[model samples]
Target chain A: MTEPPFRRVVVIGAGLMGTSVALALRRFGVEVLLEDADPGNLRVAVSLGAGVPVTPGDAPRAEQADLVVVGVPPAALGTVIADALARFPSAVVTDLGSVKAAALADTRAHAPAGAGLDRYVGGHPMAGSEQSGPLAARADLFDGRAWAVTPHADSRPDAVAAVERLARTCGALPVQLSPGEHDEAVALVSHLPQVASTVVAGLLTTAAEGHLVLAGQGLRDVTRIAGGDPDLWTQILSANAEPVARLLHEAADNLHRVAHTLEKRDAAEAGLADLRNSLERGATGVRRLPGKHGAQPEAFSAVPVLLPDQPGELARLFADVGAAGVNIEDVRIDHSPNTPAGLVELWVHQDTVPALLEALAHHGWDVHG
Target chain B: MTEPPFRRVVVIGAGLMGTSVALALRRFGVEVLLEDADPGNLRVAVSLGAGVPVTPGDAPRAEQADLVVVGVPPAALGTVIADALARFPSAVVTDLGSVKAAALADTRAHAPAGAGLDRYVGGHPMAGSEQSGPLAARADLFDGRAWAVTPHADSRPDAVAAVERLARTCGALPVQLSPGEHDEAVALVSHLPQVASTVVAGLLTTAAEGHLVLAGQGLRDVTRIAGGDPDLWTQILSANAEPVARLLHEAADNLHRVAHTLEKRDAAEAGLADLRNSLERGATGVRRLPGKHGAQPEAFSAVPVLLPDQPGELARLFADVGAAGVNIEDVRIDHSPNTPAGLVELWVHQDTVPALLEALAHHGWDVHG
Candidate 1:
């Protein structure tokens, strides 16, 4: 009836991910000790009921913990990890850092606990948003997403199992990769896209492209990730610079090739083919993308409607369209600074177009033929 | 009123735009003549009860017509406009072409219908989908988008008015841009981003980078526009090669700059600054995006929940959050691969976060500490 080795856990970061991990551990009836230097975050996490605070001075209670999960900022990763290992010599220690190779590079030598840092595994839950902190955390945040554990040569079998168990408890699928491999993969997926999105967003000059001041759905899509936290992504992209930079240059090369084909007044065959292939690949990539809960979702159909210039016209149109017996799938409105009227486009089920049209026509509307 | 000048309308080219135009004119009690060499599109338009077909051997209905709208492919734009002028010598003739410059250039010589060719004008509606053809035609399509007309120096006042009237009837705002200006604006806003999104999607080799394959909301946003019909976009980009190529080149330049910053290893000041400014711009851009019906949207906040991997978990969480009495303003989900258990993020009205968290915690759920 002895307590199974490592039961209680202490996660050393109270940011969004840390709070989420703490909340998740609570579901499985495990006592989670969530830590952070930020008073605001610690207070938020406590209010959320994720855990009660415990410090280094908590003594045997802290040292006797089976696992210490470090979910601190990437820049503070090494120091925080070293301190945890020293404080809890028998406990397995892990850090959730975006950069694997560098983060885990000093794991063994710095971890003064265990024969080696064998009980110290590395984990990265590839989940995020433009916002951050405990306010952004959730108990079910890690469910069904990739939780990568970049294991080092000196990492202990027990520590790896403990981390994996924690990941499973949080409903994440655990995958293993060497620190280098994980870094390279994320560089392509996460790091490169971040910089690319940023550059795209920055292209709009405050001058004539003052038009950039009024973007549409298309621009947002291409620039969504560009709006992420600068401090966080800086540490990520910088750590994995080699791969991210390589991808950026590769993207530029592709652009150059396409540009030259069109510049030379080539029949557009080569340029079209390049874009065609690229678009198709992107199409497939989008299809492969997971939906709300990580499942592939059906592509939504959008319907464009012409709205009148006067006020209340759009509301009336929507009300009329809704009465036509179809759910509005999505809507897009086009506005022109130079024009007197506006364009209102509605996205409905593909089957509802005719009904919506019939309804508007019945209402004596003057819509597009 | 001289019989309101020309009372009958002729829509040459039975495609979706042409047929939709014909249908909308009926809302105003106008006589419609739908002309098209494509019997299939004509049949669809007729089936939609849009218009009655006009035969080839008929005399110039121009004397009785106020407008003749030509909706033909860009390559054939010049030929169609000239023929419409010849056939409707006394009617104001206009065209629906995606690339205004090419169409204007092609038909520049056939201006001044004065009820003859002097009445000809070049027009383009900022609408259409991957799905094209008369079957996809709907009178509501142009209700709230822009319909640009590039008037030539020789354009008669009556002809321009007629074209502008057509735009208005379609519920579209009439935007008057010089052919060059229209071309450039679209190239920057519409064309460049389409190519970029497709390229990003194309760059994904998720099979190899398994975890990276865990594409989320960001990837979908960036790639949504890439699913456009390649053949159609090909024709569009090529027809407007000069401007599109220029924009693509500009984008390439920006990409290179970002790559260089990353390569310079100045993540702290230079690289990080670049990243942050990009994100800030993106956020600004997103905030500035027009909302439903082109209204300036209020910003909504995302309240992420760490969801369980189980199927019913999301349903349960949502029910609980809803029961907590917070109104949901909007929502989005992101999940990555290699991690079966993932984070479930929810978006809600801004300022409701604290109350919702309190409610969930009050229910004895572990959120965070």
Candidate 2:
């Protein structure tokens, strides 16, 4: 077996991201030393086989590690990165904070002189779940995900390569981008969506009970992210405030314009045209989202099957698909709040739709176009 | 079996809603006469066994029907209801339009002298798919759903009972409210979400390609409703413009406040508090949404299982779940783009979690808390 790129890695946090990285590295037979200020978090990470917990006397071992990964809250990222760099003089360091530019700026402003600045690279792995803590960590958390690596002008090329290798070992695709570019991109795609979802869902709090009874899949889908942990989201949004705030302001303007036009009595034609434009634009945006395997969005024919609300029904349906030897690209379950039956939409490549449909029907599944 | 509440039902407009109603009525052995201005739609509904098409020669038969259900576009709903009331003089009439107040007002203004105004009740079934047309109709479309029934002060009590009976026969729960109250309720629960989703998705059209590569479930969920049919949405929005516009305006004010606070660098503490409040409100709103069987939201523990991307894997998992003898309250499949494994979260009652987990583990499934 080849030597692992991050052989002696010290992870200075035992949160979900830190433990996940440790687990991924350990899977590749790398030696990982886990550290966290919280004893309980460290214990949980160690018990999960994420890594060996760093003891009080293991300072020398941590200093001698080949790489140190900082995975703390955004507010504490700079101090943690600086400390990691100062203590682990011989090791290169990287961070997995969501907001890149702010963390990089913080590290630069606070790092002690001769702290090996060139050895540090900024990384933000665009992967997470609403769930948190070491218990939620998975070795495959970063698999097939985009790990944004932001290297400064003065950074050593070897240091950047080490982080790239770390991402690769975690089964992630490394994408090179500047800190500003990274922040801007994520602000539009991630932060803005979170804010918008929260605002929309907030309105529901005042909704009448009768109103909520009329709720459908559209309302559920649009507000799913509002269930995220508020404390963590607040930290994330605060760290990337400027860009997120700007995008949200623009959205607010659009909302006001649409509302005004809708309320107008004489501008019915104009109001409709405006609403249609927004809807069409939204359609175009969703269409541009990359489909499975990072491919351009292509229309996948959905063959919806009505499945009984019984145990093993979904399994039976999948078994039928397996018997047909067709690959199921994606599947979605649409169940009404109190309904016993669900419409399972199996999304497949268009060319294979006919064969799959026939096979499913032959298996006595209630298939619908 | 006893005769259906309405033995002879005339369904106007052979679209998804109209056809689905006809199908449900027919299941109860009712004679249904389907009418649509479009010959092709009428043909499809008839071929689907939804109802017998209403021919020009069958005008007298349609007029003499026990009940007439007007299911036309919002723009044409008022005129259609009036026409149905005029033709079917003895029969009670109701409409299944999304917006009730406008349709009721239009009917009141346009119905000819001696028209059975007291027999007319307005309804809006709180069930639909993004898909439209007769081909999209399902026999159980309204089954186990809330069907809003708006009866005016002058509406006859017997007429109200007939509409309630119609809802019950179609397997929907009739929720009685004023037309104004119904419009206001839906504006908050349904219309606001649609507008917010559309606006947020519209912002993505201008996003960099790099931005979309990081898109995850949150982004997908928040934008799902943006894929709805633009034309139909325009009509729905226009019909209930006042209530929808007012609600959206309030949402816009909230957005502005959040944005302003987030953009203020000097007010970090206040900004975070504001952001947290929004998120907290969102959480409260989601908690109020009814769980399965129309019960108050109950916390269910999710047992996540890692399943291979192969076809039969889900089937095997479901089979294992069945063997556990536990009812799965809900299931969510979280698949990363291009990943060969997916995390399937099985939500069951908190009390059933331990047994379900132990059984799955015994079956060699990779179960996680």
Candidate 2 chain A: minimum summed lDDT over ten consecutive residues — where?
A333-342
lDDT of 2 by residue, B227-294 (tens): 77788888899889999889888888888887888878465577678788888888777766764633
Q: In candidate 2, which residue ranges exceed 4 Å CA deviation? A: A1-9, A20-33, A43-49, A57-67, A89-92, A135-144, A158-172, A292-369, B1-10, B19-33, B39-52, B57-67, B89-92, B135-144, B157-172, B292-369
Report the C-alpha displacement of residue A351, candidate 2, in angstroms.
6.9
* Index of the highest-TM-score prediction: 2
Candidate 2 chain B minimal-lDDT segment of 10 residues: B333-342
CAPRI rating of model 2: acceptable
Q: What are the per-residue Cα lDDT tens digits for candidate 2 across A12-62?
A: 898999999998998888999998887656755775677887777887777
